[model samples]
Target: MATTILETCRVPAPPGAAANLSLPLTFFDIQWLHFHPIRHLLFYDYPCSKPYFLETVAPKLKESLSLTLRHYLPLAGNLIFPLNSEKKPEIQYVAGDSAVSLTIAESASDFDHLTGNHARDADQFYEFVPEIDPVTDESEYQRVPVVALKVTLFTGRGICVGFANLHCLGDASSVVGFIKAWASISKLGGDEEEFLTKHAESLPILDRSVINDPLGIDTIFWKVIRDVPLKSSSFPLPTNRVRATYILRQADIEKLKDLVLAKKPGLLQVSSFVVTASYVWTCFVKSEEQVDDDDVLQVFIFAADIRARIDPPVPASYFGNCLAYGLAKIEHKQLVGGEGFVIAAEAIADQIKNRLNNKDQVLKGAENWLSETKEMTAIRAFGVSGSPKFDLCSADFGWGRARKLETVSIDGEKHSMSLCKSRDSEGGLEVGISLPKARMDAFAAIFEEGLRF
Candidate 1:
């Protein structure tokens, strides 16, 4: 049988390999690397557990996924394969992790079909769950992906994502490169907005204050950075990228605090970003379309930080959306005013202000929501963005920050953006976008005009 570059693996490490050999990876390999060659594949001997409504799935998924991964990730970094070498394909992985990589059928089409079904199940669950109550309660305004919902995450389903499996090591780029190549993606014009991310070390580094936690999420994050590489990489990618961090500038934060306090005293504690963000989404939708309230102007999906929104913020950053999707639909006539966009944004802003400030509104509401778990299913944010020191440019454990950072939307259509800060503050952000060509043009026109802060 003939072997191609794509099929061969685990050859003896070549002597005198390129000392600083870069990734055997790149982004979304719609070509050679198919959908996640690195399977964080969890197998079950039995059939998938019976389906409960999404209401049942929501509260349990994050906690359960976290718990499941923690058990599997016993060592320092479970999913992360260390490339702590100058050698080509920089070696990484635990003792037997490699054997698991080999335990697969020659054909992956089987896994794809199975997981595809699971993904459809996930979408069906979302379709049935009530659209989150919009300020206008317009069905058209509820948040949802225009195209596809991924069923990859469901247990017992086939593989959807690659963990830092044995063969390739680095980060999400490895995953993307493999998937893009696999899908044989051949678009040349590109969608950088949906694909801008940098390795942490790529940017000029800065110092900041520390937060304490014994076994907390932040601690785990910093742990991931212990030997974080301080260089950068040049992986050419075709996706939007973002970094994850919680550090807000003192001055920027103070300005925000003042804005919140003037609106309602002592209200700076909640995510003021939500207020501004909701305002952004509302205005963005209204400005683009002429559809009426019945037409549903909803687009941006605002994810709630349900933790801080709770009695006190949870000690850890919980994965999965502990968020609520609130839609804002304006009657067509009301939207005809000259300043309708601003007015719509202000209205959304005011709702958030009141909800967050009305005597620990977030906490009380969280408690109430948790109390009524069975009846609270609704569409929520599933995309993730990070500003972690190196989630973008400095994420190099060695090779360098990934050439790109991005989120794989469960929704097949690319309708989201990832915002990463840039030294080019003149532009102020290195925005990696990934919308279809048409939507990309429309969005660029909006930002080029510089929407108000």
Candidate 2:
């Protein structure tokens, strides 16, 4: 776990990238104001010496990142929470003052084991994660960084690229879009103009007017956040946990869907996401081994991209948080019973059909989302991050595509999991899980047994 610091630099948009910009937060963005920043790690296998990496790879990455910032200026900006209640929070950037902190370092850890499918110590990856600076108290506003970047070289092994971004700045879609753009520019020899011409669809639409909040949900969310202690925003420290990756191939997903249909014939939605998530949830609950009460509730939470579901649909490339919540709850006995997977699937399927797919009521109870979630804080509640649609493995920077990718921030949440498209198998889904070593062992056995016909 030893890592040597090379250098830390501030990377700003190249001169004349754009003028000062201010993008206001929508209700979706405001909800995450007090949460920990989302962190991700992309590991690429490249055999090279430290000198070669410093002389060749480092400059290319920094230059391409600067070029990418030109289009995603808000990423290199600050999240400003104004003291005046009337003035809403916003993502602000000053022409010459805004920049992203990039830290370059080298680690002595085993890249293969760290990127392997087997369970490994969750704290091992913490060295590669870069920390975002704490919020500063300005005269009338609190200023905090939107994003911070880190590039860790494994000497003769490979490199790990990491980023930490405030959720209020954007969601997974926006963050992935920026990464793809940066990879393209880096692969094309840092040619910003060429990237713009070839990948015009990748550019982000920064307009905040497209999102309409007719219910004053934003006001309700702001009031809730005002009572929260800002110190709670600090990132979670590593606990005694082990992280692992599991894949549900296309065939496996099909079996799960069939099982759900056999148990509940008229279920409305049995998508891969629902089935896979349900199976995972059931296994996790069973792994606990102590929750035997029939009435105890196990809550499962996940989010959906609402860009296409909105009334006047927002652009797919809109650079902000536009999401709807999907929550499902099942009793302890039902989740740990002989037909746990089927029952969990039915619950999740119904939730998606009644909430997520129902455009008219997608945001129906959003005003109480934060409060309701807080109430479940003491229960056995778990959530999922990322989505298979992101296809994060496809991100390439002239080197080959990422050998492995992880949502490192899930380590901060209690028993949360991450989902993404599989790197080796087409149409397959990858699920990342973190838990105590003993619990992880139990979950692994349950997961494998459930997949067998």
Q: 1-453, model 1: which lDDT tens digit per residue?
A: 111111211211122222221112211010111112222222112223323312333223222222222212211121222234332111222333311111111222333333221112212212111111111122222111001112122334321222232211222332233223212111111222222232122211111111112333322332333243322111113333221211123344345445545555533333434433433343334335345354433333333334344443432222112233233445545534444444444545555565643434543433233223322223212122322222233322112222323332322323333444443222233333334344445544553343424
162-257, model 2: which lDDT tens digit per residue?
Answer: 989999999889999999999999999998778989989868999988898889888888877865434424556656889999999998998889
Q: lDDT of model 1 at residue 336?
A: 40
TM-score of every model versus the real structure: 0.36, 0.97
Worst 10 residues of 2 by lDDT: 227-236
Each prediction's total of clashing residue pairs, residues at least 3 apart in sequence or on different chains, is 61, 0
